[model samples]
Target: MRVARTLTAGLLAAGALFTVSGAAVADAPAGTKGQNGDPTEAGTSFRTATAVKQDQKATADGTTGDYLYWQFPAGAGQRPTAKATVKLPEASARHGAATWQLDVFDGLRRRQACAEGEQTKRVSQQDATVTLSCTLRAVRPYAERWSNDPLPGAYYIRLTVADGPDQDMGLPVHAEVEATAEDAGGKYAEGGELGAPLHAGAVSEPEDGWNGSWWSDRWLWTVGGAVLGALAAIGGYTLTRRPRRA
Candidate 1:
């Protein structure tokens, strides 16, 4: 009965937290100005996730839910290889088995681009109460099957929740996917040919992201919650165990 009560309290608290967070995300208006005193996305990106090929669904339980995230590179097709790291939210309800995959695609302008690099994980059943979340990051690498082969243009990355059902929780995540593949050779491929002069248009800075104080507070709260939950679980288990009568 004691254990049940503790668990119930923890769950209720977590649910309340999630509700509050969702409301904040949905109802919060545009953030104020940054250090530069200009309105920005503020810890969010202009780029929104879309299913170029298929939808990637996700779910997060307390401590063992699976996480899903993906990324793509700028010269994705120009390089012979590619790689990405997917960061999972803390208190992920996923456990046990996990996996990642890479998909290639072609995009607008008949330009050569690599498709999104994908990552996935499948956790087995666990009894431990997941009080807090953890970052579950998966780093996977890929090399073009064909040498000197150019990838398709407009690459995209998507993650899918593949296993472990948790109370119908949308895979809560704070993920960022950016190009990490450096040009293998000083030379670049253009018009499907090698040894072409690199054009300035081929390289340009990505969109400016929002950076402000409010988002920092949100992240700090998330971190603090995870830490407190872990500690509570450890202490609760130690103290609440049945005393073995002699």
Candidate 2:
């Protein structure tokens, strides 16, 4: 009886461990940003925008009236949230309070509407920093229609110092941008890829239209769950079994 109890406890512990490990794996981000760059001539012109990824930080510097641009991929049926945080140096007479605006644009450079709050903020000498965040609902490509609707593709985030001290012009102010997206039920391929000319890494070519690593991870978790289930059943049986006659 003591041996059975010990075995049961060991099995239960192993099952718990497997469960925790699987959860950790599932919580891991689907992709990572491996490269960063700054925009050229910013503003509404997305042709010179930098490429970035979700949760990946990119830095740029600009002054009042100057705009910075960055782009990230958005898959179909996946909601994406983009955020930009600006940090200004110790405020001086030359650089005082300022209001910043963040705008989201599609591949065509057309502004996309936000599904949540406004993407603008006012930072002052006391604050010295400000962050702008915007969330967009799942975007779908227009089919059999002529609409200027936003589609799933390279999405641009444009940041501009809308109002600030004129003396602060040409002085560098730091800005960090990040983007994240919700899972899309495995509809799109995993591991994001950049558009072109921006080297993040050697983009993986799809094999039979599915990511092998993603499927492998799924298979591993499934096997682990099955093993854990079997161990649980064995442990329960051992705990409930009758003892042999003396």
Candidate 3:
């Protein structure tokens, strides 16, 4: 009886551990990038975009006509959203606040419509900064119907200062871009890599069953296997034990 109780306790402990680990894994934040550059030049691409947080610091000056670009992977049945905050220098009587614009493009360099959130904001002299965000509803597996709309692949974000001070372009501005995807609970297809001329082999694969908690899954599997082994041992012991004679 004592051995049975011990085995039961072990099983319960293993279950509790799995539950805790699963919760921790689900609450973790998604990946991000921190890239800064003048994307105004021709043929500029996100070949070397840096990994950054949902909120990151970037620089843009007037003279260079600076623009920032970031690329994120999206899978079928997933809806991606991108948000950005642009902080311009203190506004003066001579220098008005800057106007910023945020545009989202698909792997084919086609502009995507925003399903939610504002995509443009102007930072007035009174205000220090402004925010622009956009969401791309369900990225279909392939172009469907008459619309040759965007398909799942590398999504890019472009942030540019639409209007601002022409002189004294040395003033530095802060810009941040955040990207997120929500699962739509629909069937997903096998993921693939971005096509040629871009990042040669950059792939946008579907989120795995493990999400980002590979270690948690490993621990759960380990504990579960141990529980099963213990149960088997207890069963064998019970079957092998003989009843005592009076």
The TM-score between candidate 2 and the true structure equals 0.56
Tens-digit lDDT string for candidate 2 (176-225): 88878764443333344333311212122222111112443455567999
**Model 1, span 1-246: residue lDDT tens:** 999999999999999999999876754433333364333221211132121111112221122132222223233223322332334443445443333332322222122334332233343333222111111111112223343233322333333334544542443433322333322321222223212212212122212111101223345567999999999999999999999999
What is the Cα-based TM-score of model 3? Answer: 0.54
lDDT of candidates 1 onward, in order: 0.33, 0.64, 0.59
Better of 1 and 2 by TM-score: 2
Kindly give the stretch of ten consecutive residues in candidate 1 with the minimal lDDT sum: 205-214
Q: Best candidate per TM-score, number?
A: 2
Worst 10 residues of 2 by lDDT: 202-211
Q: What would the TM-score be for candidate 1 when compared with the true structure?
A: 0.31
Write down the RMSD of all candidates, one decimal each: 28.9, 25.2, 25.4
Query: TM-score-based ranking, best first?
Result: 2, 3, 1
Pairs of residues at least 3 apart in sequence or in different chains that clash in candidate 2: none
The estimated TM-scores of all candidates read 0.31, 0.56, 0.54
Candidate 3 per-residue C-alpha lDDT over 1-246 given as tens digits, one digit per residue, 9 for 90 to 100: 999999999999999999999876544322232245222121124543433322333333332246666666665556778887766666663266667788887766778899998887766667777889898877655544467454656677787777767872556666656777776443333234223222211434435321221232345567999999999999999999998999
